[model samples]
Target: MKLNYSVYLVTDREMAGECNLADIVVAAVSGGVSCVQIREKNLPTRQFVEEARGLVEHLRPLGIPLIVNDRVDVALACDADGVHLGQNDMHIKDARSLLGGQKIIGISAESLADARRAELEGADYIGISPVFATATKTDIAKPLGLGGVRIIRDNVQLPLVGIGGISAANAADVIQHGADGVAVVSAIIAAESPEASARELLQQVTSAKRIV
Candidate 1:
């Protein structure tokens, strides 16, 4: 796992073709993204693998860790830096068995208990949030708000990233509560210029990171 990136960006398929996914990722990297997760849900496994392979090639040379969302098979096929698993995706142990040591694995945590469990199970890092509600999830967890963010900060020691509803406007508050970084999608992909948008958010995240 590279762990070279501090700003983590999750790609939504809506940005495909239109946004030049690879270019946006590179721009994000230039803007200070530490990691990129190629998250294209609903694509057939073969289609997903094809896309993941292209991303692996694009990111590998740049030295950025590319994480595939939900599918360990595709991750292995592309030799991705890691895989990010949701609560119901794949058990951490199984993923660990497959990826073996030296590969990164990230699990999502919505509560303190989930965060603790992820640590105990050998996850490399954890994604914690809906620090505020997000329209992304069909059935989302209760908003952690800042209090929940603080609880995770006090209870866990691993690298932490806050996801869901993160934007430049309130990103400072999220990292202020104790997230190592913020994972974003819409804020960059939806902007008029992804690279410029990412640079702005990266500035905010870096400033927030310094104070935290």
Candidate 2:
């Protein structure tokens, strides 16, 4: 799986539902979001598949890749640009086998070992953090800060996205810690203006830390 690291935006289904995922996504793209991930954890598989495809179709012309969270089946059915899998979801090898080599495959990791394992298994990139505790996920990982990022930057060769509790104000800190990009849900969704929030985050998270 090959993906160019850019602004990767993850979605919170509950919050997205309140304001309309399609609308926010469209607006976010217009506001300069380069990629989008549809992460609805509670929906029935079939229903989620349908929704993902709808999003893919809508974002296709705009050129932003749509990634389905955790479900490769849903991703395949939707012909999504890729899939983002958490630690417990599926092995990277098996995901590659199923999705083949061209589609994007992202793994969620917190520790250096996990990031290294993902890279060794052929993951395109890895999401690293809960740089801070986040309301987006129920079982959030402990905060990593710059120390956690340096560990992965030191040990793994894959691009990393610093996720969890990231907002425009703290985005510079994450990138400074070695994240290739920053991924957010609540920080953007909960903002008064989603588009402006996303744009600010994008503007803030510039320049990846030089991994030594």
Candidate 3:
């Protein structure tokens, strides 16, 4: 599949407030979100699997790829498009061995070395975590400002997706710094109008890519 990381949505149930995850995701996709990652850190395994399956029903026909966060089992259970892993999660090689080479595997990188390692280990893409400090995920490593992004971009050829504190106001800068896309949490999840927020962010990313 040709992945368009342009506007990536990382789901956060708490940040979503009263809105259902399916509704937010459906709305966001309609507004131009190119990818979706379902991240459930505390939910039970069964529930996570069910949630992912539910999303698959919504996204499959739309041609959107649904990635399960941190759980190869859940992805397998739901037959998701792929899985995104953090450094502490399962190793990429093991994940690839289990998920097989056909599924997409994304890794989170907090430094240049991490990005390099991910590339060597066969990650399909690299998510540059905490491009700016973010409240959505407190345990993440130090923010990798735009400078970190540029340095990593210089070292790796894999697709880069900037995460943490990304919003319309700075989405352009993230792309200009060399990210192939931006992965966002509350920026779209917590918005009053997810469609509008997604539209605005996608516009910023698309415009910046043209310049890059």
User: What are the lDDT figures for the candidates, one per model?
Assistant: 0.85, 0.80, 0.95
What value of lDDT does candidate 3 attain over all alpha carbons? 0.95
lDDT per residue as tens, model 3, 2-100 = 689999999999888777999999999999999999999899999999999999999999999999999999999999999999999999999999999
Residue-by-residue lDDT tens digits, candidate 1, 38-66: 99878899989988888888888888889
Q: What are the runs in model 3 whose C-alpha is more than 4 Å off?
A: none
Instruction: Give per-model TM-scores.
Output: 0.95, 0.92, 0.98
In candidate 1, list every pair of residues with a backbone clash: 5-34, 6-34
Model 1 / residue 167 / CA error / Å: 0.9
Least accurate stretch of 10 residues (summed lDDT) in model 1? 1-10
Per-residue CA lDDT of model 2 for 39-64, tens digit only, reads 88788888898889888988899778
Q: Give, for candidate 2, the lowest lDDT window spanning 10 residues.
A: 203-212
lDDT of 1: 0.85
**What TM-score would candidate 2 get against the native?**
0.92
Candidate 2, residue 176: the lDDT equals 79
What ranking of all candidate models by TM-score puts the best one first? Answer: 3, 1, 2
Show how many residue pairs clash in every candidate, following the order shown: 2, 0, 0
